[model samples]
Target: MKARIHITLKNGVLDPQGKAVAHALESLGYAGINDVRQGKYIEIDLAKNDADTTRETVERMCRDLLANTVIENFTVEVG
Candidate 1:
């Protein structure tokens, strides 16, 4: 099975990197931009073939190490 993970900051959290990118875009003449948020994407290959088990394992991975549970949220997709 393969697992894909997306890790992003929760709402109300300040994102300095995202802010910097937005400012850079605006400075470069990009207009009408309101906001920008940055996140992480990760892919993993697993030995297990079961989708349910793979998802559970990946979710655990996110909670334990992949994401900061207090300030970040993660989503998992398995195939």
Candidate 2:
């Protein structure tokens, strides 16, 4: 099985990195940029073929190590 996880900061959290990127974009003449948020994309390969099991395992991984549950949210996709 293949799993993809996208981890991103939750709203209302201060994202300095995202802010920096937005500022850089404006400096580079990219206009109309209101905001920017940075995130992490993770791909994992698993021996299990079941989609439900893969998603559950990946969700645990995200909750345990992949993402900070206090400040970040994650979406998991399995194939």
Global lDDT scores for all candidate models: 0.96, 0.96
Error of 2 at 58 (Å): 0.5
Q: Per-residue lDDT of 1-79 in model 1, one digit per residue for the tens? A: 8999999999999999999999999999999989999999999999998999999999999998999999999999998
Which runs of model 1 end up more than 4 angstroms from their true locations? none
Task: Tell how far residue 55 is off in model 2, in angstroms.
Answer: 0.5
For model 1 the local lDDT of residue 34 reads 91
Reference-based TM-score of each model: 0.97, 0.97
lDDT of 2: 0.96
